[model samples]
Target: MRGLRKYLTPFAPDQSGAVSVLYELGGIIVICDAGGCTGNVCGFDEPRWFERKSAVFSAGLRDMDAILGRDDRLVAKLVDAADKIDANFAAIVGTPVPAVIGTDYQALKRMCEKKTDLPILAIDTDGMELYDKGEEKSVSCIIYCICKGKI
Candidate 1:
């Protein structure tokens, strides 16, 4: 994905860019939303979805989950997915739901770090930003992974 960007959608937001970089990283990229963001990434944004598979998932946050700020439930879900899937690392891709609820990515990262063996990445990208911004944070995550020898 370095020096190459291909997005079929007309307006690819940060969520799209995050999934783009994460798609090639071989780790689980969990979209921290109910469903819309994950749908956009798998349905159209990242063209690679149709060609290959990646560990992309939705938190399946219900209305009360977001309203009640249920970070524990999210951590449990992430840990469960980690235990079930074979992945190099795990990334929590932010979306409108967590962004609106003011989810503390650091806390979530720490929480996941305790229960899981894989490295955790927290990309706090709101749906409001552009694709480049998402790529920026995701690329930084790549660097982090590389530095930690997880890549």
Candidate 2:
């Protein structure tokens, strides 16, 4: 008999949902995970992936990166990408790697702010939850960021 799988597909997780809402918002959306999560979101989770263009990217987290909790590298990559591209805003979507490693998103946001003047937002999706939860958190964060003049 086929063994049971711990992870299921057929739907995007919270991280993907967070990215989806910000897809058309003229922002550089970064998914903080390995490439597989990005592929799933782009290939399956996101319906407009083929119809439109977005600046969604994967952080390309490696074993060392996750184990050491290297937020600096992630910040550097985001900064470089942001400098190379023109975006009205920037969003950092979290995933299992970051969640498992306890990455500091608030600090990352501050670091990104120091490097770039563009408005920045972060969705703290841990990948263990569903899509709607991510969407809700992201949307609320966007509003909060705007209200606090962080965006």
Candidate 3:
């Protein structure tokens, strides 16, 4: 396995300002929630964190949409919002409900990318894992993939 240094170097001290730089360049980071919940993982009440850090776009899914497996609306909303925001990349975060419906996030990602000319990331946050565990696993996976040149 490669050392952590290889992956961490891409996001080092100097590059710590990259996200803000991207933001200034009209890059966006959308956080999708089908569960109608909009708050930080740490329960911070500040909205500016998301606004200042990245262009955060949200899509709250409806119960009917969940039951019928009709994620087209959500995808359309995301694509439209991303286009309007002129985002360079989008990150779609799933909730428990959408996971239960088994929405094809990969397909959604492709669709969104096609429509908006932006890379899309799908994050699955449902079932047996706690939030911290899910976050750790996601970060580890991203790191490993980056080190392997898969991202």
User: What are the per-residue Cα lDDT tens digits for candidate 1 across 73-133?
Assistant: 9999989999899888999999877887899998998899899998899999988788988
Q: Residue-wise lDDT of candidate 3 within 5-91, one digit each (tens)? A: 532212111111222222343445444455333344212423346555556555667778678867677778877777577565566
TM-score, structure 2 vs. true: 0.91
lDDT for each residue of candidate 2 in 119-138, tens digit (9 for 90 to 100) = 77877888888888888988
**Number of the top TM-score candidate:** 2
Clashing pairs in 1: none
Candidate 2 ranges with C-alpha deviation above 4 Å: 1-10
CA lDDT of 55 in candidate 3? Answer: 62
Better of 1 and 3 by TM-score: 1
Clashes of each: 0, 0, 0
Give the lowest summed-lDDT range of ten residues in model 1: 5-14
Instruction: Give the winner by TM-score: 2 or 3.
Output: 2
